[model samples]
Target: MEFDEERVALYETILDELSPPDGEAVSSAHFEKELELENAYQAIEDLIRLGELEIVNTNCGHVRVRLQKPVPSSTPSTRLEDFSENTVWLAYIVSGSSPRQRRAQRLFQNFEVGEEHLANISHTDSLAQVPGLEDVWCEEVKGLSTEYAILRKEYVFEQADDPWP
Candidate 1:
């Protein structure tokens, strides 16, 4: 049977959060608290079925499990600092303008020239989501784009994509 990719992705993210280092046991209560879903109980079930986790023990209502495999790091190796401090990230949102991007642009407005100037900056085609930059970009873009991403930037150029980028 086919599973919803979005649901599977969400499940994976929860698993990542709960996964213990070196297959050590992690408290199931912690998982439920972090997940904050009515049906979070099923997530552990699904993970077990997928072989991503195995229940090590159960005490009362609490469950303990460990990662079957380690999750790979998503952070890039080059390090943004390896480039110039002037290096910035841009994402093309589907709509004409993004409030989140606009707000974020304002923070760097003094530093940014314009999107046209992107031609002068050295950049790569790769994309990554930056953490702890919520003040600049919206953590979630509700209407236009289904996926939310953060990029460090001097200038931004937005484009649109469906379901996933």
Candidate 2:
């Protein structure tokens, strides 16, 4: 897909300025000053789609960015099976005590519960390894725990609501 060069340039400038010399993550909102909010937003989407950048949206709706090229040396490995074995399954039951229960149908549990058995998800794909769960979506977890992790497709709500409208 053809992209607007000017907009792309603006996005690069924003990232370069906000990102550290060692290329740490940058927030997409930083482009608001140089481009209209919509254009800035699209720039980030376009960049990510083109594989020029990788994005992680935080629970607070902030888009975080990092260069896709050169790749981060410490990024989670691509081996889904390996990660799945190390994590403990925590299903997000609607009536469960966990705060994440209502946000989505179930979460691919991340974050420590102060127990050795509780597992942390290393990547989004790792959730697919969970038995009986399919079409998982990577999303930001809120409430009891704040993290960018995966969720089962059945649990992903298009509109935020209680009791699954």
Name the best candidate (by lDDT): 1
- Per candidate, the number of residue pairs that clash is 9, 2
lDDT for model 2, please.
Answer: 0.39
Q: What lDDT would candidate 1 get against the real structure? A: 0.41
TM-score of each: 0.37, 0.34
Query: What is the C-alpha local distance difference test score of each model?
Result: 0.41, 0.39
* Model 2 CA deviation exceeding 4 Å by range: 18-23, 33-38, 71-165
lDDT score, candidate 1, position 37: 52
Model 2: weakest 10-residue lDDT segment is 156-165
Q: What is the lDDT of residue 90 in candidate 2?
A: 36
Writing each residue's lDDT as its tens digit, candidate 2 over 15-57 gives 5554332346667666664444557766565444333456644
